[model samples]
Target: MKGGTKKIELYDTTLRDGTQGEHINLSVQDKLLIAGRLDEFGMDCIEGGWPSSNPKDEEFFKRAMDLELRHARLAAFGSTARYSDRIETDPNLLGLVGCGAPVITIFGKTWQAHSKTGLGISDEENRALIKNSVAFLRNAGREVFFDAEHFFDGWKDNREFALDMLKAAEEGGASRLVLCDTNGGSLPHEITAIIEDVRQHTDIAIGIHCHNDGDLAVANSIAAVMAGAIHVQGTVNGIGERCGNANIISIIANLVLKLPETGASVRDLTQLTSLSNFVFEILNLPPDSKAPYVGRSAFAHKGGIHVSAVMKESSLYEHIDPALVGNRQRVLVSELAGQSNIRYKAQELGISIPEGGEQIRKIVNHVKDLEHRGYQFDGAEASFELILQKELGTFTPYFEVIESKVYVESGIGGRNVDQAVLKVRVGEEIEHIAAEGDGPVNALDKALRKALIRFYPEIKGIKLVDYKVRVLEEKRGTSARVRVLIETGNGRTTWGTVGVSTNIIEASLRALEDSMNYHLFTLKATEPKPAAEENH
Candidate 1:
C-alpha cells in the first residue's frame, strides 16, 4: 500500500462485484477462501460485500472476523444513508459500523438523472446523503472510501454536480473518492480529461472502478491512474455484472510492467497465470485461451516459421518472457506444422528428437496424415504424445481390447439404457466385463475400467471429466467422420486425448483408450479418490 506514486492502493472487489457476474454464485465459505487468496496475493483492500442487503454477506463478515490477513484490509460495501436528516437511524449506516471490517465503501448517486429517478431526491439531498454517510462511518472509527457511482455518466451529464459530489466526500472525511463508470460506456480519452478536471478541484486521492461493456475497463482504469488517481479498484479475471468488471490480473500486470511506479503489491507478477487459473477453477469456468499475458495459449506458437523463429530466439515471437507471468511458450503440431514444430513439441514432452533425422520426418508426416483424416493434435496433446512415442518405438500397449459389444435396450415409454460388454487382455490374462450407463460412451468407459481395474488398480480414480464430439465433413451428414476429444482426470491432473473415425462409438472408444493409456503411462496414480478441483 505504500511503494508507488506516493502509494498506489489495489482494492479488490471480486467477492462483491465479481459475484454479480452471470452464473457466478459464491457462498460465504467461497468468499472467505477468495478473500484469503486475495490477501495472500497482496491486495490492499478486499471488499467483503454489502452487509445490509444480504444474509450471506452478513454471515461472511461475521466469519471473516477471524481471518488473519497480513496486509490487506477487509472492506464492507454499502450505499449511502437512507435519510439525510438523521444518519444514525439508517440501517445501511448501522450495518457498515456493525460489520466489523476496518474499511467501509459506500456508493452514492452522482448523476442527476439517477438522483431524480433512482433515489427520488434533489441534488442537495443527495449531496447531504453522501457527506453524512461518510461522516457517520468515519465517526464510527471506520476508514471510508466514497464510491461515486455513475460518476462518469454524471460528469458527462453535469460536470459541476459530479465534481461537487466528490468535494462533499472529501469534506466529510472519505479517504478515497472512487469514480465509477457504472455503465461502462466511457472512452479512455474522456476518462483522462474528466479526471484531470476533477484533480484541480479535489485534493483527496482518486480511484477508478470500471465495467467491461465496451471491453475497455482495463484501459479506462489505467488512464485514470495516469491522470493522478492513486487507488485502483477491480475484480480478478474481471468477473462482474453484465460484461464484468475490469480484470485486476491484467491491470496488475500492466501496472507492474509498464508503470512500475504504480503497483502497490510487493508480490511478484510472475504468479499472474496461476492466480488467473485459480479463479477460473473456483468458478468452474473454462479459461480464455486468448486472454492477455496469463492464459493457457498466451505464448503458444503453431506455425512452423514461428516455432523455428522462437527456437532460435523466443523474443522473436513473444512479447515478453512468459516466465514474468507464469506462462510458458508452447509449440503446437498439426497439419500446418513443420519439422521444427515436431522437434519442439517432442522436446517439450521430454522426448529427444534427432535433428533432421528420418524419424522426425516420419513423425511429422504421420501427424499431417492423421490431421488430414480429421484428427486435431493441438486440442489433444495427450493423443499427440502417444503418437510421438509410438513413432519413436517407445510406446507399448498396456492393455488391448480383444472383443467389444455395445447394446441399446428398448424401454418403451421410458428412458433407454446402454450396456457395454468387453473382453480385454492385459499381458497373459484376460478379463470379461459388462457395465451399464446412461449412454454408449459412458457404458464403454465403465466397462473398460471394470475389465482392467484389477490389473491397473491405480486407474480406479480416473474419470472422464469432459467429452466433446465434432462432426467433420458436414456435407456427409450423419455418416461423416466423428472426432471425439476426451478429458480425463484423477482428482489431481487432467489430460486430453482425441480420436477420429467414421463411427462415433469407435472414435469415442479410441479417445477413451488414449486417455486411460496416457494416465497409466505417465501417472501411476494409486487408489480411488474423491472428486477434487484440479487442473493441468
Candidate 2:
C-alpha cells in the first residue's frame, strides 16, 4: 500500500500487446510459459490475449483455462461491440463472453477523432457502444475493465466528450476505468492533472496504461498513481507497439524502493530480476544491459576510484542494495583498474594476495595492456576470472595447442567456401578435426569444439548461447582489431569469454579456446583435493 494505502494492482499484458513488438511472435506454448512465469511472480491480472483476433490467441486462451493459477486471474482483451449490433447478438461481444475468463477488458473510443474517423459514427452512438458493451459483460457476471483508448489526446482535444465516455463506462458497472496514453507522448505533469480531473468526476477506481514514446512511461505511471490511480498496466521489459509500453519491472522496483517514504510494501522485490530474465528467455530476446534496477549493468562499476570506494563501502557508489533485486554488484577490470581493484578481484576468486606483492601491479598492467588491444573484461566475467587465476599461478591449461589453420576455396560460380583445421594435444594424445561452414569463424568454432570433445566429453554439453563481435577501429572495418565475446551454456550454468585480434578467425579461435578452458578450469577448482593436501 502507498499514498492513500490502497492495494495496488498489477496488470501484465505481455502476451497480448507485448507481442506487437517487432519480430516478437509468441506461439500458444510461449504464451503459456510467459503466463506461468507471471503467475509465479505474483502478478495480479494476466491479459492472456484477444481471443477474437487470431486462432493462436484463441487457442492460448482455451489452453490457459485449464491451468490452475494461484495468484493471477486470467483476462481476455478485445474491443467493444459495434455501434449497430446488440451485445448478445454481436459475434465480437459474444466471443468476449464465451472466452470463459473471469475478467474481460474492452476498449472504447474516448477521442472524438476516432469516433468520427475510425468508427465513422457520431459521438452519441460511440457512447452508446461503450455503455452497452460494458453493461453486457457485467450482466454476464464477468468483471469488466474499460480502457479509454487515447484518453489523454482525446481529453486535450475535447474534454467534455472524453469525460462523457468515462462516465458511460462508470454507469455501465465497469470495475475499473483505465486512461491510456496510447500515443505515449504525454508529460508527467499533464498526466497528473488529467488523472486528478478524472478522479474528481468518477466514483470508480482509476488505472493508468502508458506507452514509452517519450521515454516517460514510467514517470507518467508514477504521476498517475500519485494523482490517485490504484491500478497500473504495463508489459514486462516494455515490449509493445512502436516505442513500447511502460516497463513494469522498473516501475515496481522504483516504487517499492525509491518511494518507500510513501509507505509502499512490496513483499518480494528480489523476484524482479528473475521475472525480467524469465520473460527475456521465453521471448528469445537479449535483455537490455542498461535497463534500470534489473539489468546486468545496473550495479556494475568500473574505474579505480569507484572500485576502491565500493570495496570500502558499497553504499558509496551503489544507490540500493543489488541483492534487493536478486542481482549482485560487479567490479569491472579494465584499463581503469588499479592495484586495489586487482587485489579485490583476486580475493573474490579465493586467491590471497601475498604481503609486499608486486603481482597486483603486474596484473593491473597486464589487464590495461589487454584492454588497450580491445579485450573487454567487463561483460565477460569468466574470461576475467581466468585472467585472475593465471595471475595467481592457480590456472592450469587443459590442453596444449599444436596448430590451427583456415583454408578457403573459390568455386567456378565465384562462390567462396571456408574450412578450419584444428589440432590440439591433451596430455599425450593429439586430436585433429576439420569442419566446413559458411564462414571462417563458424568453421573454426565447429572444428575446435569437435577436437576438444575427443579429450573431454564435457565439452559436448557446452553449447554457444550468444556471439557478439565488435570492431575496435571502426575506420578499419574488416582489418580492424576485432573483439569477440562468446556465451556458452552447459544446461546448468552459463559463462562468457572474450578474445581480440586483427584477424577475425584468430579472434574467434581464441574465444573458443578460452570458453573450453574456462569449463575445464571450473571443473578442476570444484574437484576434491588430493589425499596428501587434505591431510596437511
C-alpha RMSD for every candidate: 5.4, 2.9
Q: List the residue pairs that clash in candidate 1.
A: none
Q: lDDT values of the candidates? A: 0.89, 0.88
> Over the full model, what C-alpha lDDT does candidate 2 score relative to the true structure?
0.88
Residue-level lDDT tens digits of model 1 in 411-509? 767779899999999999999999999899999999999988898898898898999999998999988999999998889888999989998988999
lDDT of 2 by residue, 295-389 (tens): 89898888889988999999999999999998888777889888767777777767787856677778888999999889998768788888878
lDDT of 2 at 514: 86
Q: What TM-score would each prediction reach against the true structure?
A: 0.91, 0.91
User: Candidate 2: TM-score?
Assistant: 0.91
**Which residue pairs does candidate 2 place in steric collision?**
none
